[model samples]
Target chain A: MAKKKSESSVSTVPSPASSRAAGVAPSHTDLLRQMLLIRRFEERCAEAYALGKIGGFCHLYIGQEAVGVGAISALRADDYVISSYRDHGQALARGIPPRTIMAELFGRVDGCSKGKGGSMHLFDRNINFLGGHGIVGGHIPLATGVGFAIKYRGGDQVCLCFFGEAAVNNGAFHEALNMAALWKLPVIYLIENNRYGMGTALERASAINDIAERACSYDMPNEVVDGQDVLAVRDAVLRATQRARGEHTPTLLEVRTYRFMGHSMSDAASGTYRTKEELEEYMKRDPIIVLRTTMEKNGEWSDTAMTALDEELKAVAQDAWDFADASAEPAVEALTEDVYVW
Target chain B: MPVVTYRDALNQALQEEMQRDDRVFLMGEEVGVYQGAYKVSKGLLQEFGEMRVVDTPITELGFAGVGVGAAMVGLRPIIEFMTWNFALLAMDQVVNSAAKMLYMSGGQFNIPIVFRGPNGAALQLSAQHSQAWESWLAHIPGLKVVAPGTPYDAKGLLKSAVRDDNPVIVLEGEMLYNTKGEVPAEEYLIPIGKAALKREGEHCSIITHGKMILVALQAADQLTKEGIRVDVLDLLSLRPMDVEAITASVRKTNRAVVLEEGWEIGGIGAQVVDYIQRECFDDLDAPIVRVHQVDVPMPYAKNLERAAKPDVPKTIAAVKKVMYLDQ
Candidate 1:
């Protein structure tokens, strides 16, 4: 097989001018703020989990904030979003209220899924956020179906399906991609290659480490982007979404990123499967700091302003925690509700 | 009214529903180009065109999930599995995604999709292909399991299943595809979760559904000649089981025998027995006897396969046992 050129390889550096030329992009400061909010929200979630406030398996999206924030920024309000279990960032990026997400984590009735979905199964139909499906690669087919519906209805809406690198190994991934490609459905299969699927390293799980290369079998257009850079992920995803909406074509995008925390709260962040050196190397390219430095270089933000912004985000996270704490548990009668529709 | 085969009845239901609703479409392996594996979806592709009657790759999980996704967003998808045995590959999507989406999303999504296919034993398909899944699927809370016996019920119930705003599993009998029955010339729909009394009798009630209904009828005819009138109750829908119809039949006859094409343990008969004993214990003249396929994987040998399945003799024996005439 010949080496396939990644569509995103040409644009490694972030250019605000290019982003502006792309038209109506989120300001650099706004993107930074959103990523910061997600970081703080995840940190608060870890603290709450330790305090026995948030039960069930809680997978934090600490390091891969840029991938979620950047990709979701490109999608239209009517478009659908579906992701794997590590979904706090995606939920926040899709504009689900932080309080509702926090309440869902707290298993409250005010939660998005009314305490039924808990952490891994957050859903908001109003914004078209399909779900935070717990099973790996299980939601891929759903995304395909969403695309099929759009085509069947003669709509230009696109579906964005996000999964980890480990999900590529699942049979569902291949099956969904094949169907989407064959049908010429409007969908974007975004792979957040965070280097580790739970404790299993990407090298240990997948035969071909370059996740985008696997898309060749489906004859779908594919790209690899620097997931640590918010602008790069945004550009690639925007292009993919446009292709999906305009041409009714699906794209397989592999965003190279990493997670700073363990797979979930259960796994110790100790360097057992991975080394401290590897973790430190990825941390040096931390997505938030990378974007913040770019803004600083452009003279768009100041040190004092950045500090104030961090404090504001912290306050936002604190308010969400407080709101979730005060929310009521779901009524026992609600246990049977929504199970069936007549 | 016209006489039609079970396969033609199902095809008519699909054609009618597709014509009635543009949102409803047929999708499965060989459904479009090959006219369905058993011709259940025959002439549909040519009628509805490729966009509606989609021919999918041999990927059950993928197509099943796609059907679910489409249903979530306001499309009524009719996903044919070719066979219920092959649906095992896509059970995850069926059970986890399609069935639970409405509840998990807190009533935001109602998957109005029908997963229909031929189920249970057919000739010598044997073991892997011959297993009946009505009991297993009925065990699920969010699903409606429909197994029709006659062509009339097949067409009417399927039309209703397509219209239902929930995940409905229509288990078509493979052996009954060629069987003929009279169907209404005009439009009609048989409501799900309702039973039909094929034959009313005074002595004993033989309750069954799907292909076993035929065996029950034959047995009823044999018992009638011996001066033992038997009530043949056909349970068209398994889930949301028609307990009222069952109790009424048992009450009328004061004796009952449950028959099934599936394994004896944890089968539909077992569930019917539980309902009868609990609700109609006073009306029963004797303990209800269950006739079901033997508790073993269906063997490929002709004689062994015949012995493993529930047949006319077995139904007669069960009815006799309930009537105290088998000793």
Candidate 2:
């Protein structure tokens, strides 16, 4: 948890907009700042989990930052988003305050779910971020239903559902995809294929090597994009969202990324399942570094700017930690509230 | 008053609610084109159109989860399982998603959804197809469960459950669907947590819900011939249970007989027994007795099925035992 150095070397690179790619958002600085803030916030979470400040299954979004930043960047604020448990990155990118996410992780009243839902289940209705669900593939059908509601009401809004590669084999996934396809619901099913379902590798779990090909079973369009590349992920998601909004069709997208940390804090940097060489290989394509290197090479970023932004975000994470630490546990009487709405 | 089948009453409730609100829609297998497997939704597809009266594949969990998701975004969905037995596949969405969404979201989203369908044994369906789901479904804290035995209660409870602003399980009586009852020709809504006095008496109280109301009434009739009058209380809703009504009935009669169509252990009768013991123990003149389906998988043979099922004779015998009429 010390100050980390930049991993990507600066070279000639194209700007986000020029390649007609999902490259970067309109502002290079903002995209860089957003992804870095998530990195810093969750690094603190890892530290807290180690110290027992945060409990339960805490999964960090350490290495796979670009997929969240760029994909969410393509979505309008009105669009709905639902994610699996490794959700701090997407929640932060969706513009939910770092303090709220941090507080929820700490199990405080100020948390989005008022501490009723700990690390796994985070919900914010105001921003249309549906939730961070716990069950593996259980939420895919829920997302498809959100799309059904949107279409039923004739609303142009779409939903982006995030899940891991591990969820593909689940019956819920297949069933949801089939319905989403049959009904032409406006949902973007984004698979963050970090290559492991806990300790089991994707190759061991799935029959097909290409996760996006599973979409063919439902006759849905799909894309396989570089999850490490902010622009590429954004571009693919932007196209998917366009298809969703304009045509009311669903798309399945596989964002190939890697989890730098173990699946959860219970497992360390995952040396048991993976090798140092493989870990180093994925570490080189780290999302933050990939985006920063491109921007710096384009003369849109600098070492001074990166250092200043890093400090600012670190303070933000610290303030969030302080807020969560100061917030009280939920009142005892609240135990029975919200079970039913009279 | 107009005499109508329970299925017709339920149909009227769905038609009225859908006509009243644009957000309410029905989704299930065979609900639209086939007009419901039990014909509970007959003529609905033609009236409401295919969009509102939807038919999904045999994906119980898929459609059920879809209903939960749709409900989260402000639409009121009525998800019908073909039977309560098939709802086992959809319990994940019912229990995990619809029931817990509000609490888990810190009270942000109230899943105003209703899961409705026929429940309990019908003839000799036996085993997998025949299950009285009230006990298991009622166990969930976030869900409001209701079982209506009469046509009047069915119409009113289904209408109310659609608007309850929480996940509700409407355990419709499969056998009672074809049975005729006098329903008032006017609008009415039955509150989800009250019991109805089907027949009032003095010697004892017979508490039941759904189809067991008929058994309780029949038993009460024969008991009257034996100079043993009893009060038959029909518990329409299980979760926001009408404990006050139960206490009043048990306190009045001084003896209680619980009748249900489900298994004995951890049954609805057991919960009622717990409530009665805690509330009306001193008032009781005799130990309470329960008449429920025998503690075994429903047998397929006609004789074994009739023996396993709790019928009017079982109810009468249970009441007589509590009243000390039969040694």
lDDT tens per residue, model 1, A108-159: 9889888888888889888888998878999999999999999998999899
User: Can you list each candidate's DockQ?
Assistant: 0.77, 0.84
Model 1, which residues run further than 4 Å from truth? Answer: A1-23
**Highest lDDT model number:** 1
Per-candidate TM equals 0.95, 0.96
Query: Lowest summed-lDDT stretch of 10 residues in model 2 chain B?
Result: B124-133
lDDT of 2 by residue, B178-221 (tens): 99998888899999898999899989999999899988888889
Spell out the clash pairs found in candidate 2.
A22-A231, A22-A235, A23-A231
Query: Global lDDT for candidate 1?
Result: 0.90
Model no. 1, DockQ: 0.77
Residue B33 of model 2, lDDT score? 90
Cα interface RMSD of each candidate: 0.8, 0.7
Which docking class does model 1 fall in?
medium
